[model samples]
Target chain A: MEAFKETLLSSFIVFENQLNGQKKSELHKLRQKAFEAFEKYGFPTRKDEDWKYTNLKPIIKHDYKIFHPKEQKLQLDEARKYFLSETDTYRIVFVDGYYASWLSLTTHHQYDICTFSALINRYPEIADEYVGKLINHGDSFTALNTAFAREGAYIFVPDNKIVDKPIEILHFTTPHALPAFQQPRSLLVLGKNSRATVIERHISLSANPVFTNSATEVFLHTGAILDHYKIQTDHYEASLIDNTVYQLQGYSVLNLTTASLGGKFVRNNPIVKLIESMAEAHLWGLTKIDSSELADHHTSIEHIAPHCQSNELYKGIFGGRSTGIFNGKVYVAPHAQKTNAFQQNNNIVLSDKATVNTKPQLEIFANDVKCSHGCTVGQMDENAMFYLRQRGIAADKARALLLLAFAGEIVDKIQLPELRQYVKRIFNQKNHIDFDFDL
Target chain B: MLKIKNLHVSVDDTPILKGISLEIKKGEIHAIMGPNGSGKSTLSNVIAGKEDYQITQGTIEFEGKDLLELSAEERAHLGIFLSFQYPVEIPGVSVTNFIKTAINENRKAKGLEPMPAKELLKLIRERMELLNMDKSFLSRSLNEGFSGGEKKRNEIFQLSMLQPKLAILDETDSGLDIDALRIVAKGVNTLRTPENAFLIITHYQRLLEYIVPDFVHVLYNGKIVKTGSKDLALALEEKGYDWIKEEVAI
Candidate 1:
C-alpha cells in the first residue's frame, strides 16, 4: 500500500512538472479541473463495473515518467513502408507524444494542421470547449490521460470543404530506460457540410513493455461525413489502451473501423453518441490474436436523439492459448424514438485451450425501436477440415485456408481498397499464410 | 492387384466382418452384394485404413504392399480411392483447389512435380464435363449446398481426376437419380483399364447393368456365402437376399 501511494504521488508530481511552463490559459484551467478529478478518483479498482474484467494494478504499480518534448528524430523511410500504397494523404508524425514537424508532410495552404501543443497555445477557445468533455472522468485511465496529455494532433476540416485525400497521423514511440508512458491525444472536428478520411496508426520501435494511453475524440457537425480508421499493430511486448468517442450531430454519418493484429495486452473502448436527429454511426473491428496475447474490445452506442441508427460488428480469431473478450452495449434513451440499432460479436477459437468471452447487450428504454444483439463462440468446422484434408491439402495448410476464409467476411467489408489490401497483407504476414486469391 | 485374406474386423469390440476373404486381379471389377448388417461398408472402410475399425485377424495387400501398415493419406498416395457414400461438405475451399491438392500430393508422393495450374484446370474441366457437372461448380465450395445427385456426380468426377488404380465405390448409387447414376457409371466405365480394378459395394443389381462386374459375391453374416457370374445378380434381384440365406443354410 505504501508503494502504491508513492507511485501515485510521483505520477502526480510528474503531471505537475509537465504543466508548469504553460501560461495562465483556458486549456490549463481544463487540465487543472481534470487533475482535480484524477486526484479524487485516483485509479479504478477491479470492483468498478467497467474494470471488472480488466485489472490495471500492474499498470498503476510502476512509476512511469511522462514523455516530454524531445529533439530526437525517427527513421521515416522505414515507417512509410507500412502505409497504404495508393492513397494520397498528408502525413503527420508524432514521436513520443510530441508532434515532430520535420517528419510531417506540408499541409495545403487552405487547410490547417496543428499539433495539440500548438492548439493549446494558439486556439484556446476550441481546446477549452472540447478537451476532457467526451472523456469519462470516472475511468482512471481516461482521467490520467487527461491530467497529463502534453501533445498530440489537432485536425479541423473547414465548413463546406472536401478533403479529397486522407490525413495520416503516425504515432511512433521510442523505448526509454524507465517504464515509459505516452498519452497521445487527437481531436478531429469536422465542420458542417464537410467530408474527410483520417487514418491514425500507433507503432512502437522496441519490444520493451511500454504503456500507450491514447484517446481520439471526433465531432462531426451537421451533414458532415467522417471515415476514421485506427490501426494498432505494435510490438508484441507493448500494452495499449485506446479510448475513442464519436459525437454526431444532425444527419451526419460516421464510419469507424479498428484493426488490432499485434500486442501483448490491448483494450479498445469505442463510444458513439448520436446527439441529434437522423444521425447514423457504423463501427466495425477485426482482430487476430495468437501466442498468449490478450485483446479486449468494449463498445457502446448511445442514441440520445430521435430517428437515429447505429450498427456494429466485431470479429476475432484466437489461436495458441490466446484469450479474447468482447462486450458491446447499445443504449436507446427514453426519448430517442424510432431508433434502429444492431450489434454482433463473433469469435473463432482455433486451439482447444484458446478461450473467448463475448457479451452483446441492448438496453432500450424507448417504446418504439428496433434493437438486436448477437454473440457466438465456436471452433472451425470439423467437417470442413476433413473435406479439405480428404482433398489432399496438408492439415496445417487446410486449417490456414479455413482461417483466412473465416476472417475474409469482415476484411472484405472494408470499402477502402488500399486499406483493405494493407490489412490483408498484415493478416497474411501475421499468419504466415498467403491468400493468393483476390477477396 | 488387390487381396484380402481371413479379414476379421471389429468396431468397438463388436465383430463386424468375420473371416472374410476376397481377391481381384488387375482389370477386374468385383461386386459385394449384401444385406444391411452384412458389413459391406465396413469392408471398404477397413481396406482404406479408417481409424476406428480394428482388424483382429486379416491381411490386406494392394499392389504387393501391406495396406494396413499405411496411413489413410499414405494409402491414398498408393492409388487407393473410396467414393464416399455420404460426401462431406467443405465451405470456402473450391472444388478445383481441392482436386489439385489431391493430385499434387499423390504426384509428390510418387517423386513427381505438382501439376501446373493451367493443366490441372483443363483436366478438371474435362472430367467435370464427363460427369455432367456444371463448370461453375468447380469454383464453388466443395460439396457445400450441393444436391444429392450433384454430390454423387462430384465423387465420380474426383475419381476420374485422381485416376486411382483401385477404386472402391461404397454405395455410390444410393442417393443418385437415374440420369445421375448413368453419368456416374459412365465416368467409372471410362476410367477402366487393364491395369486397374474396382470393388463395388451395393445391395441392388441395377448399377451392375451399367458397369458389369466379372465376379458377384453374396456377403451374408459378414462372410461370402456365394460367388457367381453376372447371372447371380439377376437371380438375387428376382428372389431377394432371403433366398441366398436359405440356400446357404440348406
Candidate 2:
C-alpha cells in the first residue's frame, strides 16, 4: 500500500479509539463500516474507469497531516473575499476542518441552519436517518470522507417553508508548515413543497499545498425546489476532489451550476438520481483553466421513475497547455417510460497545446423515452474573432470578448443577481478582461 | 482621402483582384458595381485588412499612411470601416453593448477616455431613431435571429454610430425590403458629411437612386473596366452587366 494510505488507516484507528463511549453510537458504527470499505479499496488509481483521465500519483505523494489542524482565525475583511457580502445570506464557515463560529451567521428558528457537529449532538436520530444514506458505498473517496470528516454545513427546511435568504457554506484552509489534508462533509434536506438556494465554495488563504476531499449529499422531498451553485477557484497549490450526490423525490426540481476556474488538480463527480415521477434536474457547469492546470468533471443523471426530465450542459475553455475532461452520462431505467434526458458538452481550446477530452454517454432501457446527447471540441470561432476585431477591438481584447460571451450563456442562468455579478467579477479577474455590458 | 494603385489580391494563390486601382476624395461617394465573382467584395475585404486575402502586389495609402502595414483594428482606428456583407451573430452581447465597446475601443486607440454613459446613451438613442430601430432592439443580442431587413438596418445603425471617415458598404442592400432599404438609405444620407467618403459596393442600382453617388466604377474580371458618373449606374441597371462584359472583352 502507499505510505499515505497506510498513514490514513493507522490514523483512523487512533481517531476511532479517541471516540471513547461514542464508539457504540450509530454514526460511529457507520464510520467503522466506511473505514473497512476504504481499507479494502484504498485510493483509486488511473486504472479505474471513472478516473481514467485523471492521475492521483502526484497529489497523494505528499505526507499530509490529516488528523489535527491547528486553530486558525481570520478577520472579516480578510475572509470577506469569499462571501457574497453584498447580499444577505446565512453563512456556515469552517477553517481547516474546524467550524468558525465568529465568521458564520447560522439560524435555528423555523428551519435548521448550523454545522453537522452541532446537529449531530442536538439531533442524533435526524443525523443518523440522513447522513450517509445517499452516498455510494463503492466510491472510496466518499467512504474516506464519511469515516473521518466530522464538521461541515447542515440545513433542514421543513415542509411548506420558503427560505428567502440564501445559505452559503464556505471552507477555507490555512495550512501550518506541513501539507494539510482536509475533508468536509455537508448535507441539505428539503421537506415537501419547500424552496431554498445555496452557494458552496472552497478557498485557501495561503500558498500552501492542500488536498481537500469533500462530499455533499442533497435530498429533495416531494415538490421541493433548489437552486445550488458551487464555485471552485482556490489557490494554485491546492488539489481538490469533490463528490456531490442528489436524490430527488416526486415533483422536485434541482438546478445546480458549478463554475470552476480551477487549481493545480481538480476532479468533480456529481451524481443525480430522479427516483420518483415528474422530478427534474438541470445541471450546468463552466470551467476555464490555463497553464498546466487540470479540471475534470464526470457527471451522471439517472432517471428511475416515469415522466422525469434531466437537462445537462457543460462548457469548458482551456488555454496554455491546460487539460480538461468531461464525461457525462444519462441513464433511463425500464420503468421510466416518459423520461426526457438531454445533454450537451461544448469546449473551446484556445492554444494548440491545450487539450480537451469530452464524451457523452446515454443508456436508455425504455423504448418510449427521449434521450439525446451531443459533444463538440473546437477552437474559438475565427469568423467571430474577425467580426469583433474589425470593430476597432484589438485581437486579444476581441478574443476575450468572445470567450466571455461564450461563458455568459451559463453565467446568465444564475438566478441570483448578486451571485451572477460575483461570478462575472471572477471571470474578469482570472481572464484579465473587463467586459462591461450595461445592457 | 483614399488611393489604391495597381492593387492585386489573391486567396490561396487564386487571383481575385488583378491590377485594380481607384481613388476617392473627401465629400465624394464611389459605387462599385459588378456581377457575382467579379472581386468587388474582395477589394473591400482587402481594404478592411482581412487576413485571408493576400495583397500580392498593391500600395494602398489612406490619408498618407501605408494601409497594408496596419492590422484590421488599426485600420478601423484610422477611420476605415467595412459594413460586413454578412454580420456574424454574437449571442450573448447586446447591440448597445457591442457598439459601446466598439466606440470605446476606437477612443482608446486614440488615447481618449471612454465616452460618458449619459452622452453615449443619448448618441445611441439618436442613431437608433435615424435608423427606425425600436428601443427594444438595442437590448437584443448582436444580430442573432434578426430578420434580413433588421440585420441590414442594424448595419446602417452601426455605421451611423461609428461614423467612420471612409465607410465601405458591401452588399448592404442585398437582404432588405423596400421600406428597410429606404430607412437604411436615409440613415446613410443623414450621417454623410463633407469630411468623410462612402464606398458603396452593390450589384443593383436601386440603392443608388436614394443615395446618389459621385462616380460609378464597373469591376469586370478583377479589374475596373469602366468609370462614369451616376448616369453610368442607370445605364448599367437598364442594360445589365453583359454590356460591360462585352465592353471588357473588346
Candidate 3:
C-alpha cells in the first residue's frame, strides 16, 4: 500500500514533466487534492463489502511507473481489425497510454469529438468543472484516476445539434515501455435536446500485465439521448477497472451496456444519477467467463427526481473455475415520488467449480411507487440439451447454440447494427466456434 | 427393420417396462395403445436411447446395428426420430437455424458435407407447406410461445424434414385438436414410404382413423398383452382397457 501511494505521489512529477508550463499550472492544484484523497483511502481490501469478490492487491502491488503517451508508430494494418471498419465515425485512438494521431480521426464539427488531454489544454475551466464533479471520489481507484486524468476521449454534443454518426473511442494497450498503469478519463457533456451514440473499446496488442483505471463522466442535458457501449476484449494478462457515471437532467434518456469477454480480472462500476422528472436510465451488462477469469459488475441508479424510472439487467455465464458477481442498487430520495425502478440479475454456472453472487437492492421512500428486483442462478437445462441432441445437433454445438441464445437476451438490446453484430461476432471468434444463428 | 426382444426397462431402480417384445418391418405402421402408466412412452424413450431408463435385459437392433451402444444423437444419426410428446422451447434459436443445425449434423455424422443453403431452404419450405404452416413460423424461436397444437405440428414438420428410417411418434396426438390431429396425421401419411417405418404410440384410437396401421398392440402392465388388426384399436377405444384387464385376469 505504501509503495503504491509513494509511486502515485511520485508520478505527478513524471506527469507534470511531460506537460508545458501553462498546462501544468492549470491542473496542479486539482491533481494534489485528488492525490490526497487517494492516499487517505489507499487500496480497498476484502473487508470492504464493495470489493469483497475482487482483489486489487495483485494489480497495485507492482512497482509501477507513470505512463506517458509516447510517439510509438504502429501500422494501420495491425490495429484496423480492432475497429468497426464497416462504420464511419469520429475515432479517437490511444496507444500505449498515448494518443496515436496517425490512427485517429477527431472532429471539429458543430460539436466537439476529440481527446480529453487536449480538452484540458484548450478549455481548462470546462474540463475542471465537469471532470471531478460527478466522479464519486470515495473509491480509491476513482481518486487515483482523477489525480492523473490526463488521457482519454472528450465528447460534447452541443445543444439542439444531432451527431448522426457514432463516436468511437478505441484505447489500445501495447505494453510498450514497461508494464503500464494507465488512467484514461473521458468527459461527455451533451447539450440540451441533442442525441448521439458513443462506443468505447479496450484492445490489447500484447499480454504484458497492463492495468487500466478508466473513468467516463457523462452529463446529459435536458431531453438528450445517448446510446453508450463498452466492449472490453483485452488479453488474459491484462486487468481493467471501468467506472462510468452519468447525470441526467430533466426528460433525458441514457442507455448504457458493457460487454466483457476477455481480461483476467474485470470490474465495471456504472453509476447513473437521475436528477429531474421524466428522465429514464437503462443499465445493462453481459459477461461470459471461462478458465480462471473473473468479472464483477457493480451498477447503481440514483433517483433524485420525481416520476423517474430506471431498469437494470445483468447476465453472466461461467465455466471452468471462473467467478462472477453482479451488485445492483436503485435508490429513490424521499422527495422523489412515483419513481418506478426494476432490477434483475441472472446467471448460469456450467461447471461445478464456477461461482456467481448476485444482489439486487431497492431503497424507496416514496409512497406511490413500484419497484421490483429478481435474481436467479442455475445450470443449462438438461431437457433442452437433450431435445437439441435428439434432433441431431452435436453436444458441443448444441451447448454453444444454447449459450449464444441465452446471451441474446442482452445482446439483442444493442441498438447499433454493426456494434450488435460485432459483439456477437467477437464472442464467437474468441470461443473458436461458429454461432451463426440468424438472431 | 427393427427388433426389441425381451425388453425390460427401469427408471431410478423402479421397473417401467417388463418383458416387452416387438418387431417392426419396413413399410409397416404399428400402433401401441395402453392406459395411463402402461409404459407406452417408456418404450419410445428406450428406443430413442434416453439415458435415464436403465435397460436391465433387452436387445434393440436397428438395421442390424446394436442400437443400445449409440448415444441419443447417434441414434438420431442412424435414422431414428422421436416426435416428442412435449417439444422443448428454446428462446432466441429460430426454427430454421435449429433444423439446419440438426440436418447438417446428421449429414456430418454420415461423412457428408453440409447441405447447400439453397437446397436446405427448398426442403424446409416444402415440408412447411406439407404441414400447412405459415412461412412466418419458420422465423420464430423453436417452440417458444407456441401453443400445444403448434408444438405438435412442429414435431411433424421436423419429422418430415429429417426423414429418418424409423420414426417414433410418442403421444403426438395427446394435445392436438381434431383439425391439428388430421393435419399431423396427413403429414405422417404423406411422408410414409415402403423403405421407412413408424411406431405410433397413442392413447386414443381417433388418430388411427387418419393413420391406418397394419397392426395394433395392447400394452398392459408393462407387457404387450394383445396383438391384433386395426379393428382391435376401434374395439379397445369403444370397450376401453378395462375389458383387456379383465381378460388378462381370466
lDDT tens digits, residue span A291-318, model 3:
8888999898999999998988888888
State the C-alpha lDDT per candidate.
0.81, 0.90, 0.87
| Candidate 2 CAPRI category | medium
Give the range of the ten consecutive residues with the poorest summed lDDT in model 1 chain A.
A1-10
Model 1 C-alpha lDDT versus the unseen true structure: 0.81
Off by over 4 Å in 3: A13-27
- After aligning candidate 2 to the native by TM-score, how far in Å is the CA of A101 from where it should be? 0.9
How does residue A235 of candidate 2 score in lDDT? 73
Worst 10 residues of 2 chain A by lDDT: A67-76
> Residue A337 of model 3: what lDDT?
91
Chain B TM-scores across candidates = 0.98, 0.99, 0.99
Better of 1 and 2 by TM-score: 2
Please compute DockQ, using alpha carbons, for every candidate against the native two-chain complex. Answer: 0.36, 0.75, 0.79
Q: Report the Cα RMSD per candidate.
A: 3.6, 1.6, 1.9
Give model 2's DockQ, 2 decimals: 0.75
Q: Which ten contiguous residues of candidate 3 chain A have the minimum total lDDT?
A: A22-31
